[model samples]
Target: MTAKFHAFLQNGTWELVPYDASMNVVGSKWVFKIKRHLDGSIDRYKARLVSQGFTQVPGVDFTKTFSPVVKPATVCTILALVVSCGWDIWQLDVHNTFLNGFIAETIFVHQPKGFEDNNYLHHCKPSLFIYSREKITIYVHVYVDDILITGSSSAHVSHLISNLSQTFDLKDLGPLHYFLGIEFHRDAFELILSQRKYILDHLLKINLAAAKPVSSSMATSFQLSRFTREPLSDSTQYRSIVGALQYVTLARPDVAFAVNKVCQFLQSPTDEHWGAVKRNLRYLKGTIDSGLIFSAHSSDTLIAYFDADWASFPNDRRSTGGYGIFLGSHLTLWRAKKQPTIAWSSIEDEFRALANTTTELL
Candidate 1:
């Protein structure tokens, strides 16, 4: 508590104020955490003081309306120079930092109960400006999905169909023709999987599933942001399409990264994010024939490659790491994940990636 309090004081996170009867006051509480070593021994105890910020009023307390210091032109100019001149790119991650701006409002957090400090007077102003880094608070949007059933047995399939027909309002679409947008091709040799019909229907649903297919998964210089000024009104449609694209990744690993990036803004999708999703879908339109192939070949050898992008995230500047593992010359496992801790250097980030990949190999 003392360490955190002193750190807060040094950071100037908030100013002490007197108890005010007229203005609304916010409450705060202490949070506790424990850090442990690799051997599971206790390393240290951590405490944080968090404000109950739900009490803050919109107009009276703070205003988020502000202009960006770095204009769109500046970002484009820098990127254009890099593309043309082939410049080296560098990134850095610095935590506990904010773009400190002056604010005219004078709001305050109330003093803790029973702690009478002279500095915490009745009416005091605390927060000076909004921090550039804010904690992620996710509000997941829910959508209902239908279950698709499949198995290999004429007798068993018939028995299960009789049971389901007895239990609920069942429509017997014989031979597993098409269920939940997935089309199946089965014969004596093997059963093939494809979403050609589903993709086409959804494309026509959005009036672009059949549009000219693009060669790229996503266009170069794709601009996406969480704080985009213009938000799409059909955010629900965006969410649904993104969800479908996620299912498509089950069969198509090529578009996984692009789809994963777009899925981040399901709750509040911007027009830019929606456009990126459409680009990915258009890519899928070209590669609808792409599907996983079943093979009997097996090998005992395991091969893996790991890499990391230092300070990849624009919002928090956190590094991202990923690895791909191949067993017997076939891809068995692969993942792309963001690093938990910020890396100070490229070497540090790559070392962390190696460590994580080694763990996965084990």
Candidate 2:
């Protein structure tokens, strides 16, 4: 706690002021975490002091507090592009990035525990800074503090690291071995991306690691209905498994359609739904060894395919549409979703699915 307070003070995070009752005081808390590498080695212990933003009034305290995140598809596309050329990947962490934002509202947060402070509130700017030169473009994607640096040239990457090091308190973690829970393993030719640890942890979470394996994500003879007489005692458990399964679809595109089917029942799931979830888990059990491998030999060609099952939803008569985008020979992106508008015929549903795929492709 002393170290955290000292660091905050060193970063000029906030100034200590006299207690003022007129200003609303927001609460602050210290968050402690242990950082680890992709190989399960301890990197460092982290301490962060954050304000209880829930205590702040929306318009008065801050007009907006929003941050953009890198989309999973964008990550996949970038990875495919990088691996297609077998280029190097790197990661950088900006220390105290949350404090980098420009605050517009006057909000006060109570001093952190074991620290002397009066109040707190701050807004942030883009915080994501980028620079590029002719034939040397370096891009940084900042989802809050975690930054990913990648580009075409090795020299450009190194230069960007030097520039970033001079500007902010940054850690140059060499090579992007891991980012956003996805692990990268590179060889002479291709980069293999996997969520093995995530899958094992997920299996352990629901106590299904030792369960019997199945070849298919969904039961061949089973059909799910909206009606449920015997709902699971804990609906959260169903939601939890379904949510985790969604992430599993990241590397295993084979399960995308199956997982999307389960996601639609998040609000009210029953034992029947849980049974289907278990079936999906069992499918994962059999296919835990599979992950996305982008080979350098494959051409960086884009191909998208779309199809639909006209008026398939038993509850709403809405058609189910599916699309897959392939980067080279690798399936980089895919989705299985219910259509928003009810289609009158299969031709209309096909056209709708085509339009959706076109939007994604464009």
Candidate 3:
């Protein structure tokens, strides 16, 4: 807690101010989190001073909200390039990231409970920035404070890190073994990206870790419908699990279709929908180690394959379709989603999926 408070001081996150009865005072609290490694081991314990931004009056206190996030496809593409080129990849983490943002809004907040400085005061503020070198080329992908850096030259990469550390509080986490919940396992010929630990953690969280593994993500006979069975008494757990499964699709495209099917009924989930979700989980249990493998011998050619299921959803006549885009031999992008509008024929649905894939490729 003291370290977090000191970060606020060093970053000039807020200045001490006198308490005023008329000021819109936002409550502040300490958020504690245990940082863990990819193997589920404790990396460190972290605490951050956070403001209860929820209590603020929206229009008055904040006019716009923006989140600068790197696209997943972009990250995958870069990683694939790095693996194929046999480049050096490194992960970096910024300390006290949120404290570095400069907020223009005049905000008031109560002091942190234990580390209250001068009674009551309020302040607040909150990277997608990249740096590159000359002909050797370096790529830096930033998602908030977490960074993934790679370059063709090892010495150049080290020099870049040294330069970055001088300006920012940086943690050079060696080679990019893990970042953003995905684990990268690399050998001489290939790099395998997997979320085995994430999958196991989710299974344990939902108490399905002991369930028998299944061969398929979704059973052929498992057709879910909102009215097929009684609605869940409380839909919170159903929504929460389905939402969590969405993240799994990041590394597990094999379950993307199954997850997309279950996600359709988030609003009014039934026992049948929950059963399908459990089946997907069981399938993931069996294939927890599966992931996208980027091999070094990949070609530069881009290939795309798309297919459609005409009017597959019983609830809606909309067609279900998906596309897989491969660069050389490695799959770079894939998506399983329902069409926005119902197609008149199978060919029309197929064409829709093809058009979508072509758009993505372009």
Q: Among these predicted structures, which one has the highest TM-score?
A: 3
| C-alpha TM-scores of all predictions | 0.47, 0.87, 0.89
Q: Tell me the whole-model lDDT of each prediction, alpha carbons only.
A: 0.58, 0.78, 0.84
Cα RMSD, model 3: 2.7
Model 1 residue runs over 4 Å out of place are 1-193, 220-223, 358-362
Q: In model 3, where is the ten-residue run with the lowest total lDDT?
A: 119-128
Q: What ranges in model 2 sit over 4 Å off?
A: 16-24, 39-41, 57-65, 118-130
Residue runs of model 3 more than 4 Å from their true location after superposition: 17-25, 56-60, 99-107, 119-134
Candidate 1 collision pairs: 17-121, 18-121, 18-122, 18-123, 19-121, 19-122, 203-209
Task: Tell me which residue pairs clash in candidate 3.
Answer: 101-126, 109-122
RMSD of each: 22.2, 3.4, 2.7
How well is each residue in 35-139 modelled by candidate 3, as lDDT tens digits?
A: 998767899898877789898888888888777777777787887888789898999998766634456877887777887644343432213344454667777
